[model samples]
Target: MKKIGVFTSGGDSPGMNACIRAVVRACIYHGLEVYGIKYGYDGMIKGEIIKMQSHSVSNIVQRGGTILKSARSTEFRTKEGRQKAYDQLKKHGIEGLVAIGGDGTFTGAKIFSEEFDIPVIGCPGTIDNDIYGTDFTIGFDTAVNTALESIDKIRDTAASHDRIFFVEVMGRDSGYIAIQCGIGGGAEIVMVPETETTIADVIKKLDTGLRKTKTSSIVVVAEGDEEGNAAEVMAKVKAENPKNEYKVTTLGHIQRGGNPTATDRILGSRCGIAAVEGLMAGQRNCMAGVMNDQIVYTPFDDCISKSKPINQDYLKMMNILSI
Candidate 1:
């Protein structure tokens, strides 16, 4: 408990630096030596750890992405790799750990915590917002806004050109960003992976709303929708409705970058401090998350095994509100 480590793994996300800042400062405030692990679990095996000071994390709260950096460590998947990482921790006297990332990060942390004597606490840092314990993940709000901003701009061009636009947002495993931006951008149709909506349905809706009545319109689709991304779906729709003008825009990693919004900074800060405090409280193999505006810890197994479902009402709202 006197010395601890923190690292960000898997894909990087906005507000992660704020989380790292909070974690480093909080540990230092509680009179614990903090170590920064670079390049995630891979860094542990490589012994790429450095002691952090109060100033180490200063002025990073406004920044996007993680200061500690993140990566998926293929080597860390093996038992031998994990043992090496454990030995390095023992060498550095790091008693506990705070891991930041999405489900992949938590899955690794859970296995490592169970295998070794060291304890670990995770922070949800994915843009997908699919983690079960918390109402929102660290980067989801920022990602949604980022994608929405693009949709707003695309809407202007969509109108100017008198064309239908298919805008793709992130979320391969979840449809959060697409659903949120779909409603917020006032799209004619929204497509997600969770629902039973089909490409045929999208085409029919375009015919009903875009082909005849409206000169321009938008359709927001998640990357993981049953048919395909925005481009593929647009192709199918274009083929069926040959007279309709169409354009495809994949928002891609633009949603992943950019400085986090005010909401994300607060969430990251809260989760970061909670993680450090949770470790001191003898809580292990769990995640620090904000549920209903209060800090709560959920077991890692539950966070990983249970999937957070999207609001069905949000999907339904699109049906009534969009038309």
Candidate 2:
């Protein structure tokens, strides 16, 4: 039987463990020996490999983070490092590899597959959900929900004190989490990187809302929002309305770590199993994504080159609801 290897690279996400479990179990169920790589590309370079069995992955479907761990290794950028990883693959007779990560992780997998003829299949696992091929990545749902809950909690305090609360959510380039939570939690203002939010725009929106009836406001800001940091933006707003009162809370790394939500668990499992099936079918340099409620394998090159834009239709719906 051919041996298959799986690893999670880049930042840790809530549903990574679920993806790992799904990949391992899927491979083993199909009579393929499964090997787990620890610490992402760093482990592959250092040959930190472990064999995985059904018992090894038991009850991990609901867990958070990756069992194999992850890292951003500069060494993996070098040809020598990749060569070492390829050599390790040869030594272990791992003919196929399933890599779970964002775009960077897929870049490495693409190179390894091309250079050594080792089949590699990638699964979109980032909470950012910025990957092109997939409509939704594994951990995005859970992250959005987590942000929503935090915003809800913050709203309680804002209402009681008749204050404005600025809640910062994690999203470097993409505002998927911020947008979802903003709409879900009934935020008064949302600052996203996709569209630069000006101080005037915020004032106008909040003034409209304030004139209506609400005594307080909740503003959801993506970490990459324009006009400097979210704290600074909030400060500027506070300056305009000193009596408005406002507090800034950065969710930071907390959004990245948590047990996979129900949606994430199910999504990760389906994506993982689909990845193994794709590789077993001799597919290489492809990413597994969910589209139209079905798993579709798209070429890695297409996935990397394409841009996944935010759903403006949903954004418009959110704008209506916010009013």
Candidate 3:
């Protein structure tokens, strides 16, 4: 019987458990032994393995975060650690691997698969939605929803205080979350890494809004932006308009944990099953992603080499809505 192992690496996302459940169920349905690798690549290096039964994964598709938990490991970046992971895989008689994570984790998996000659399938699970090949990564919808809710909450305070608040949302290199939340929540200025924005331009916009509108303005800034930290930008804006009171809030890991929204749950299930199917169909060193509403397997080499570009339509929507 074919033996398969699944692990979640890097930062944990909302739909990871759903992906794991689909992987395990799909493997079992196909008469393969499914093993859960705990703590991601670190767990593999440490030989942490658990055989998963159907009952073990029951009702986890609706859950947030990873059932196996997740951690980053510099050891996993080294050849020695990869050798240990290979040794553990051989000891357990694992024939294939399903890796769920972002770019960094996929890089490690690509190295391991090449070095060990083991088939590995990847499922994108980052909230950042920056992974290549996939139009939407697991947890992105949930993260956008979580961030929008936080913005709504902060809006209540901002309105009462007549304040301008700079809110920071997570997105390493992509601005998916920031754009979506800013648009959904009707922010005054949306700052994203995808587009360049000068402090002068932002101030002019905010000043116009303050002078013309009674409602407090919201500026949604992606963590990785040209203007630096959202908090510092808020300070500068406040200094320029000392008469206008403002506040700053940074939504960090909170965006990474939450019940997977309906879209995330469905996407995770589809992508997870697609990962197993890719492996069984002899698609080696590829990642499973949804394109044009159909599952497709992309070579890991291409996935690691480039990232999915930020959706310009969504950016346009944000701009229109902000206006």
Candidate 4:
């Protein structure tokens, strides 16, 4: 491909700028023109394509969030909207695309490529770390560390007041963040969506800790847990044990910001480079992913259709170590 385009779609994640940088520079290095599509598929539909030079991505490897920005396009979900996006690509003479985002992003790219016969590649770029193809998606490491840091701070206050804390992290439908942060943060109980965690189970764990004379404890819960978020879980726990002192904190978007970690930057760069190289090698409708520490191309269909289950081993280790 002589000229190609790149965009970040769906939710923004840390290390996205780094991914964009790698795509831009990698394309430029291969003597190909790079175009940046602002605001994701919406930008493509609106013809918001801009020529990207190597300097356009300079000094962004350490940045958080996406330089091209991202948005969910309700319109892009329709056939007419995708036609408009394809027309824009034709107007810019863009021959291929690199889409960076989570499941929704890959689903859109997969359909668009089939509809237009265009070459497209994907990069796993979400804090959720739930993308199927990659062992660890870009921004996951940074987000986990951010939540761990926050939990550490909260622990101090919980200890000072001799209270229990319900710490919530991102992962609306997945528990990768919660599981990692729970173990790393030394949480007494880690609740995730992959496995059912009941209020009685929580109370039982708390009672066990209390009987052992533990003064303060942290329970990390995924936002998508069946039992609800930290606040809801804490409310139920408090209702059952009114004498217990409990506090709730939703980490919210705080885990999505800040400079990308070194691991994320490196992963983003590797995936970005692989994406452009894959396009040059005539790979289409695939995502660039790192599996077992090696760069690999995964078909978009598999990525979207398959579910990446959380490591049961992590859950087991969390249980054993949290004691």
* TM-score list, all predictions: 0.98, 0.97, 0.97, 0.99
Q: Model 1, stretches more than 4 Å misplaced?
A: none
In model 2, which range of ten residues has the least summed lDDT?
237-246
Best by lDDT: 4
Residue lDDT tens for model 1, 170-228 = 98989999999999999999888888688789878877875466888899989998999
Task: Name the lDDT of candidate 4.
Answer: 0.94
In model 3, the clashing pairs are none
Whole-model Cα lDDT of every candidate shown, in order: 0.91, 0.88, 0.89, 0.94
At residue 24, candidate 1 shows an lDDT of: 92
User: How many pairs of residues collide in each model?
Assistant: 0, 0, 0, 0
Candidate 1 displacement at residue 55 in angstroms: 0.7
lDDT-wise, the better of 1 and 2 is: 1
lDDT score of residue 239 within candidate 3: 69
Q: 1-323 in candidate 3: lDDT tens per residue?
A: 39999999988899989999999999999999999999999999999999998898998988898999898889878899999999999999999999999888888888999998999999999999987788899999999999999999999999998888999999868788988898799898888888998788788888877678756889999999878879978877766767777788999999999899999998999998999888898877889999889898888889889857777887788667766
Off by over 4 Å in 3: none
Candidate 2 residue lDDT tens string, 223-275: 88877567988889878867677789999888888899998998889989998
lDDT (Cα, tens digit) per residue for candidate 4, span 239-268:
998888999999999899999999999999
